[model samples]
Target: MDGISDVAVGVKRGSDQLSTYKNTISGTDCMNDGASNGSDSKKLKVDAAPPSRVLHIRKVPSEVSDAELIALGLPFGKVTNILTLKGKNQAFLEMGTEEAAITMVNYYNSVPPSVRNMPIFIQYSNHKELKTDSSNQQTRAVLPAVSTVPSLSSDNQEAAGTSPVLRIVIDNLFYPVTLDVLQQIFSKFGTVMKIITFTKNNQFQALLQYSEPAHAQQAKQALDCQNIYNSCCTLHIDFSKLVNLNVKYNNDKSRDYTRPELPTGDGQHSLDSAVAAALRKDSSLLGALNPLSAAAVVAAGKVALAGQPGVLLVSNLNEEMVTPQSLFTFFGVYGDVQRVKILYNKKDSALVQMSDCNQAQLAMSHLNGQKMYGNVIRVTLSKHQTVALPRDGLDVQGLTKDYANSPLHRFKKPGSKNFQNIFPPSATLHLSNIPQNVTEDDLQLLFTNTGGTVKAFKFFQDHKMALIQMSTVEEAIQALIDLHNYSMGGNQHLRVSFSKSSI
Candidate 1:
């Protein structure tokens, strides 16, 4: 069963999900007010909005802002509306289309849940079958999920007498099995709701749930002996022992099942005094607020304190020691930062802002669990985030951009169509069968960030891929890692394997 949230974040958005969605369907500019229209008026239009594939997001980070969640959901396809229940750790997301949803479900299930520290969950949802009208609850166990689950006809919502619930015994579960990998396995047949696995005498076992009986049948038929994870050792699948073994226990939150915090996170952004003041203002930062780790305390009060809200704070830094530029220098490695500031006593910790909250979130995640310089830095979305003064200038000695614009002065055709146009001769990649969606602009963005200067970019007509030349191997490696598993408007992941050139 999927958990529902009843906590309203201020006045709840209206149920006009269709028009509200059509207005800001991309979720880019939700802050701007939009117009209203009658169903008849909308029907009068030429193209009616197409139905979107719905997604069920399980175990979303409680502190993730609605805006941040929307941005993260964009990779799946176009997001319509991201509805989160404030107190509830679950959410329901609807994607622009089913194809995009499929790609999202499969891809994100491999994301390891440790990106920025806060875990992200996405699976295909089959909410239609969560029937209500007095169905047998005993043998019929129902589940909900979003994106990339196996297909099923609407015929068997509830098997008349609630035959034995399919018992799926999963093997090869790593000592610390991850949610991402677990989702990838069970999402094959149906929505997987619960996983109960504990080691016995150095062996592991788990019970998986499927939304439909047909899904259980299909999974048994398709993956009975299939080697999961490319393992040669055959996995065991059993039928006829179909029965429900639901085990519920008190969650201790201290269990190691949670993903580890990133190595680089710390709240060194604030001064010492500010950390104390914010803790004084908000008493629960160091204490437990909701059974997760202690509320995060940021040293972000040193730069400038604005954008204050209700994120629990806990820290041990002197806010005055932090500077916006210092934190910017520390954080710029991740991506472009948009703002920074410190709050509390106006002298301690500062909240550093990034061009996107997703980047900031990613930074905060891994950084929260480590020590920096001398003190331990705790990083999480502050229930309250402060704003800092704008405008910036920084050192450029070690960066590649400074060198890209350096005085090589050997002027080639600025807009050359030469096969080796953009890159220098030495480091080149024979990217084959690249989808047409990968444009020169996208390639430039991909390569430039990795320290390569794309003097020229082109596409091949015969097989659809392009030949990219890099100035150095460092740049090429970065490009390969960052864009390795990319999807370009299709389900095909951007595969990056070594290729030997005929040259």
Candidate 2:
């Protein structure tokens, strides 16, 4: 009876051990399943936040402006309104539609927010839309942008009814499309008879009369939907009902092509007394305004300050990309480039002397801190009055006729075979048929300033041929696209192509 009791106790102990082992396996499985579900729940939290149209972007770089914010949204969709608190490092952007906002949020959230080298964070705002002051908005009703070419469309029979009188409405008003700019662009189509600029419904509208209706049509067809320079000044042109544009007055708002008083922007122009007085008054009031108003005034002040003349020191340049002529081309856009001296002591730096301090200031304000040839161009006033030219290297003095003549004018005389001619981008660009006067630095300057990083440069035994190595295949392609058939001095058109062997 005692032996039977011992066997029964041992069996009871074995049963308890089996139970404990089963419990341990069950707890471990529960933990493994919980961990997987936890990860899924986190991902759901990110994806399931109810899609919102309005995004409240936080942690924005303080230096970021409203324009930069608008630019960020441009890739996704049209941005209706942008409010930036530079001091607070936050911004609110209103997209054209809800879908656009959602798309932008989804894409950016998955990635990271970065602008101007500053990391940013974007999230949905509690408010569906941003509230803006009606008084603050520059409510202008400009002409609507024509999406399709109605004039050239087959369905429209009136396409042939060209009119010499063209009513030009600038599609984009954010750009400072001035009277002189219109005259220069329209002049290519035909002799612009006269121009009158007026603000209608808060939009910039202009009346341009050409010598012939055919010329007006040609200009409209060519320039319509095309940006003037960079990307801002888009032209939306149409034929006017009137046969001729009347020029009743000669003032800031109107300019007759026949009038000699109109400035050609050749560094000889000055603001009238009335405009000057208004600017001075506004400058005095800069301290009292809010953050938004202050930012606008500051930008205006920069342009106004650019009118001052002095020597501008440009640094942080890719030595392969910078050249005296390229510097002349860029700075000349703002003011007259009197002289350009690439520093021999510092090959990566240079000094550009503008005609006056105003021009120097303007160049510095616009071109300073801008990316050129994979580097931010550092523009500042030089302590020395002028840059001393090196005896050995090339120095550009006075304005090149191409630059002094017009703003961003390339490929002069339309319909030249050069218009259709194109050279694909490559890593190593082969250059031939170069002019004797054009130095290696000149060629390098042309490529780098126009979005290229020169990795290597070589001239063959034949001085006319040279090989330029860009930092990447894409940069080489851009150089080839921009410089092919480019007139270097003495009627020499640049011959550019890709080299099979990497230099």
Candidate 3:
């Protein structure tokens, strides 16, 4: 252990001060020459060797346990053997295959492995494998039992890269997908042990772990490239690199079912609160299948709409053209509009109420930055619990209106199909419920009359449904506001909403 002196002295000065920590310590002969040449000679040896099954790890803290070192290699592949040089503060790990070793090295090269918050170095070892006598007590102690290590067999790994965990990416996510939704969907196949949801590369992604690898494989096979709802919220699933997930909190973003007593963490609401609220309200807003029970829908709503209010404060409107009914119709594209109150003095501003917080959140997410009546509108959660009506005898240009019992509420019915087709506003609009007699030219003329350009149009195989692309999103918004529930001949009202697909 020639380099032992440098590392031992560096350890005293703290890991931050170790500038030569990146050097790879090879065999006995190199370690013998390492003290004199320092990092320069070791750096040459580091690049001289090609990929191998054994990886040489440097700057391993003496206090770090064998299990910690093994855990580092577990994510990449199986760790067959390990040999720790306590005096040199280094170790050599033997992966099950050379490919696994190369993957580990490449990954660590960018992310850089750390144990106990201390940075460590990993590179391919010159030796292909570690040779240790099976009779040696130390060697026996270092080898982990196959049962304890959750490594996939080579056959299973080659077949589908099977693991106990799945990585899920949600595409075209118009409606919020909560952790409870994921648990309910995956638990139908097996026991969902844990889940972690995050946003990466501008996409909503999740890591879910099942109690068994077979469960994960089944769920992946069934769910990959499938839509969570009728046509949107597509799920792209694959086997996660991780064999298991480490969930620290039982909150909306992450959960550990085995450890239910864990804290919800800061700024997070407990599942109990979400479930209690969901039970008291309608559960149709969550369109995902609930194999667990109605309670899962409640939990999904609570987590998805946590901290959101049922009322929205809208501002910067076109005062001359904006109206209570117009605001109700526009916002109703995303939720059931309950009430609307246009500020009498500030005509450009208004307060809109939805059936519940989930609806309000959905509306805000979609229409906050959207254009309305030739002006960009701003939508935010209102501090007021309810929009107060004007005095009984007094009327301010009839600005406020109550739609609590209005038949136009799209999400009023439980498990409404309307919940499944929600999408963010786009230039293309999905038009449905068209009168059979209404021709494409008639619809095009109607939308064009709204002072917007009609880019393209295509009727579905069933002429009752069609896609219309406008010159811009603003023009489409204007068309939707003007024509959503417009009366067609024979009492049929046209239905309009944003479409995820282009014509």
Among the numbered candidates, top lDDT falls to 3
lDDT of 3 by residue, 1-503 (tens): 11111222222332222223324334542343232322324532434468898887777777775546655665454556666665667777778779768867876775677775567778777888665433332332233331122334455545444578777787756566766557645654556778877644335677788877876776665566656544556677767656666666776568876666667674242323433342234221213433332111222222234444689999999999998999989999888888999998899999999888767866875676578887878887788878887788677488999998898888878777777677777889999999889898999999999999999999999799999999998999889989988999788898998887887
lDDT of each candidate versus the true structure: 0.38, 0.53, 0.68
State residue 208's C-alpha deviation in candidate 1, in Å.
11
lDDT tens readout by residue for model 1, 1-503 = 01111111110331222222233223221111111111112211223223236665545555654434433444333444455543335455555567656656655665444213445545555441222223323212211122224444455434412422333333332111322333344444454444433322222233444544566555554445433322221234443233343323212101111122212112222112432232234211121112221211111110011222323232444454455444443444333444555454444455655544434443453344333333466665664443434334432221112112312111223422221111211245546446766677776777787656655445667647776766643344445545554666566655442222322
Better of 1 and 2 by lDDT: 2
Candidate 2 vs 3: which has more lDDT: 3
Shift in Å, residue 100, candidate 2: 0.3
Pick the winner on lDDT between candidates 1 and 3: 3
How close is every model to the real structure, measured as TM-score?
A: 0.27, 0.29, 0.48
Write the number of the candidate with greater TM-score, choosing between 1 and 3. Answer: 3
Ranking under TM-score, best-scoring first?
3, 2, 1
Q: Which ten residues in a row have the lowest lDDT in candidate 3?
A: 1-10
Model 1: which ten-residue window has the lowest total lDDT? 1-10
- Model 2, which residues run further than 4 Å from truth? 1-49, 133-225, 228-503
- Which candidate leads in TM-score? 3
